[model samples]
Target chain A: MSVQDDLETVEWDVSEDAHITVDNEQCITCEDKPCLHLCPAECFDYQEDQEGGIYFAYEPCVECGACMVFCANDPDKGAVSWSKAEGGKGVEFDFG
Target chain B: MTDVAFDVVVVGAGRAGVAAAYKLADEGFEVALVERAKQPGMKNVTGGVLYGSILDDLVPEFPEEAPLERHVVEHNIKLLHGDAEVSIGYRDLELREEPNYTLILGKFDRWFVDRAVEKGVTFLSETTVQDVTQEESRAVVHTDRENGDIACDAVIGADGVNTTVGRKTGIQRTMRNEDMALSVKKVIDVGRKTIDQRFNLDSDEGAAYIYTGFPQGAATIGYFIYTFDEYISVGAVGGLETLRWLGDEGYGETGTPLYSLLEDFMELDNVRPYVQGDAVEEYQGILVPEHSYDTLPDRHDRRVALVGDAAGLVLNKGYTFRGLDYGIKSGLVAAEAVMECAEDGDWDAFGRRYDTSLEDSYVLQDMKQHRHLPKFLKNERMYDAYPGIATETLRRMYSAETDASGLTWRQAYRAFRRSDAGVLDLLKDGYRGLRSL
Candidate 1:
């Protein structure tokens, strides 16, 4: 099964508001978008339609902070801004 | 900074944050704990094993009401190449008690935070710390909520692997992908009876198994399986570069995405049977501070000290996992340092004692001992070639059928090396592994 399929197996409490945002322009310049490659959540996807840009979402995020941590280290500063969603929001683990 | 301040403010109510808050409060220092999650442990996850004698110091006895899953008495490490595998394990009754627990963070941290709460620690849950600024006499913590800013004599940034509080204190700079290991874990519901029979454990006894070199596995990735109460936690993690390699390799060896590698590992003959009808309980991913110890974030900086993943204290001792132990231990150490500064009434050099105290503890020493391990692990041959060498050689040696006049152990060993690795490379790895591990 795909990661999405496995993710479907686990319960999720999706937050309407997002705590993370990406600067797509900066991402276009990023030689290798680590978030698209490494984020287990698959929150960021490469959308060639936007001139080889990225399609970003935070609802599926496991809130592990990998995406933010990776993006922050990029020389293209401020490409990704991350924070924990407001209290009682974001992905909550049942058996974390 | 507002006048609404305490003696100490511990950021993030994780293992380290709670530990520091508990110790500080018991010492009669007014402590404030702010957690981004609605409650403690809600935002936390770990391929967690609480080994070593650290938690005993925090909670004399983890209350029976505590959600401690199991006591891991068996240490199993294996090398998997396809369905066939080789593992060497040790199970001891003496090591089954306190501190050696299989913890589910969502439960354990709640129980632990309560212990701190009883000591008069004021907890601010569902509060996000916006920024932390260190001043001459105290550190000011600004929160997203109104009147949430707190001024404290000291700040303990146990906020976890993604460090803002740490960077604010200048204790940690920008963290690179090379400095972390990324993982996605699933808690599968294999019945208690199935777990017991499959893992060969008595009731409440758990086994942690680490496997390397599965069919699609590389030198950088490791698959971990742990029997957790009614759920079996199975997962994988590797260095950032290695994961990048997996990403670079389109379709990988499994001819699918990276997650497919995990499903593939699970579907193998040896793995598939154990969890055939098991349900998937939970799935999540985390970025852990398993970077080489040399890249460890500064332990403390002036009035602001770091602990847990924020401090980059997790040690990836090859297959063995140890993070929460250091996270909790350093909380106690951070508490001691914070108290010393509070007594002296000096916030500038407040946590100066943390460096020396950690040096005196086994935490720093353990990281120091295995400082070279990260580089050793990067040597792809160890994971790529070694597991195959070990399993195949053992397979040929153990087979009772007379195959080519039944080679001796020494001859079989040479033959295994002949296939994948040469003698020189194997010797080099052994020498490096010895010095590093």
Candidate 2:
């Protein structure tokens, strides 16, 4: 099955509100946008129609903290800001 | 500082926090375990096993008390080169009963906290700690709730890898992609009967299979397949930097995304039958320490201590990954230090005692021994070149049946050894690996 097909069975408790924010300027500097490949949820993608050319959909986020650490801590990188959803309204692991 | 209401406060109600609370409560200390989740373990990503000998000291009758799924008796490490694989497995009947177990952390954490609560430990659920700072000799645990702030003589940061307490309190620095990993796991319901029959488990026994060699571009990636009572835990872990190298294009032409890797792994020829009819029950992801021994901060700092992921007590040697056992051990060590600090009324010495306590324990000692593992493992050759060479060598040796030309065993092995790195390079790598691991 495809990733989207497998995701149909996976459950997520999305915060509704995105707990992560990305800076347009910061994202453009790293055209690679490494977070797109590293994110397990595939919550990020390129949007040719958007202002920043990067689109982020947080609902599918598992709150893995990968994007946050990868972007925030890089010596020359600062594009993504991440924080846990309040009251733990994030991905609630059913088997995790 | 003198207004500390509780003797000690532990953050995150997962394995480390619960273990710390239980130990502190047994020492007659008023301990409060705070968690962001609705309940202990509810937010935890389940799967994986608790390895090493640390569990025995934490719980004497661990097998009976712990919420374990299966006792893993077989371990197989596979080097997947193309569609071929080379594996080494070991199984022992006696070791299958106790000490090591495959766990569903969501269930285990809850069971662990229940045990702690029964030991006079107070559990505060739905409380997310905003910051952890020191005030004189006390710790102020600020929460999101307006009036939910708490003060304790000592605080234990038992939160996971994305540790707010450790990072905010300056006990530890922010994690970098190089030192972290994005690990994804999926729980597949394959039926207990099918699992038993396919894995050849003699009731309650399980297997742990770790694989590498994901194309040449994504060679640094590793995948794991573990057996549970009625489920199979399949997952993949890649170094953040290495994973980033794949970009969105995915490990070459395959265009594999992070989640798709699990699906691909489950569909492998060798794995297809075991999970043929099974369904994906759960899929989750989390950030993990990438085995840099420095991932762990100083055991304690004045009125505060760090344990588990917050403390970064992880020993991931790639082949034999670990966190659970080390998490429990760190909690026990931190708890012992807290008990001593309360007994002596000297919080400053808490840090020293904690370091000393862990220094002698297997957690720190084992970590120290393998301190060079990360550097050694980061070699790109390990991912692509080695797996290819190993698999080819085995293929050549095993092809003696089809060879009428009469190729010697030594010639067969030598044929593939030259395929990748030469003898000198292999010798250097072998020496480095031996010393590091």
CA lDDT scores, all candidates in order = 0.77, 0.76
Error in Å for residue B409 of model 1: 2.8
Candidate 1, residues B1-437, lDDT tens digits: the string is 39597989998888888988998888898999988777678788889688746766567666355688888888888777655687889889988554587888888888888888999999888777778887776789988787878998888888888866877667787777677777888888888988889878897998888877754347667878888888888887766656665634332221123465677778887777655654777788888776676777676777888888888888877668888888888888988888777677666776678877977778888989998997897776766577766766776677765363555676567666576678888788899999997
Q: List the residue pairs that clash in candidate 1.
A: none
* Weakest lDDT window of 10 consecutive positions for candidate 1 chain B: B249-258
Report the CA-based lDDT of candidate 1 relative to the real structure: 0.77
Predict model 2's lDDT versus the native. Answer: 0.76
Screening candidate 2 with a backbone cut-off below 3 angstroms (N, C-alpha, C), the clashing residue pairs are A96-B44, A96-B45, A96-B46
Give me the runs in candidate 2 sitting further than 4 Å from their true place: A12-17, B1-4, B217-219, B247-256, B294-299, B400-409
Per prediction, fnat is 0.57, 0.65
Location of the lowest summed lDDT over 10 successive residues in candidate 2 chain B: B247-256
- TM-score, candidate number 2: 0.93
Q: Give all TM-scores, in the order shown.
A: 0.93, 0.93
lDDT of 2 by residue, A1-96 (tens): 655665676655666677788776776666566666677777777777854567888787777788878777775768888777676566667678
